[model samples]
Target: MKNQYQVHCDHIDVALPYARNSGDGALIGSMFGVCANGGANGADDVLVVKGVFTLTKNSAEAWTVGEKVYWDNVAKNVTTTATSNTLIGVAILDAANPSSTGVVRLNGSFS
Candidate 1:
């Protein structure tokens, strides 16, 4: 049994693709996670791959609980639209139109 599990999968160290702030959502390839700390691009930081978090969302879109949510990497926000976006998780609460945030539960899966 040479192969052994080292750490819990809930969090991981990643080479940031861009400068990020703590609590920000990050998409690396098809994997999505919340930044546990702020860091410059190419810096090593921890990403929480699971758990619920309030994330930035499209200001004009409304969301209901259980609705699928996507990450708009360009805008750096969660969105209801699927096209050209990465599926990160689902809405865990209702988000009003003109709102800037939404509650989501991260799926912690690649795409």
Candidate 2:
């Protein structure tokens, strides 16, 4: 397979909530990290690693299946969380040839 550039979302509480609130609505605010501070309170530890998904922008808000997205590996395993809300990408099993933009070149961790 070719090299894929996958973004690693920090093990942050803010990120987890975003993943949870994905299908709730459009990216209204906080285009940045919501989990701040080194010794801050964490949500539940549910992590996720998203990928390129479709976005129904300009016209309306929607979570298409081919636009830029994020992902969380640590959270996935640690929390066994659900990213159905704000995530886009196949699991490691179906992500053989990951897209360049939404690929996680992880060795064996989040394969």
Q: In model 1, where do residues sit more than 4 Å from their true spots?
A: none
Residue 3 displacement in candidate 2 (angstroms): 28
Instruction: For model 1, give the 10-residue run with minimal summed lDDT.
Output: 1-10
RMSD of each: 1.2, 14.3
What lDDT tens digits, residue by residue, belong to model 1 across residues 7-109? Answer: 6798988999999999999989988999999699998999888899999999999999999999899999999999999999899999999899999999984
Instruction: Record all residue pairs in model 1 with backbone atoms less than 3 Å apart, i.e. clashing.
Output: none
Q: What digit string (tens of lDDT, one per residue) describes model 2 on residues 40-92?
A: 13233322223322212221212233333333333321111235332333333
How high is the CA lDDT of each candidate model? 0.91, 0.27
Worst 10 residues of 2 by lDDT: 100-109
TM-score of each candidate structure, all chains considered together: 0.95, 0.19
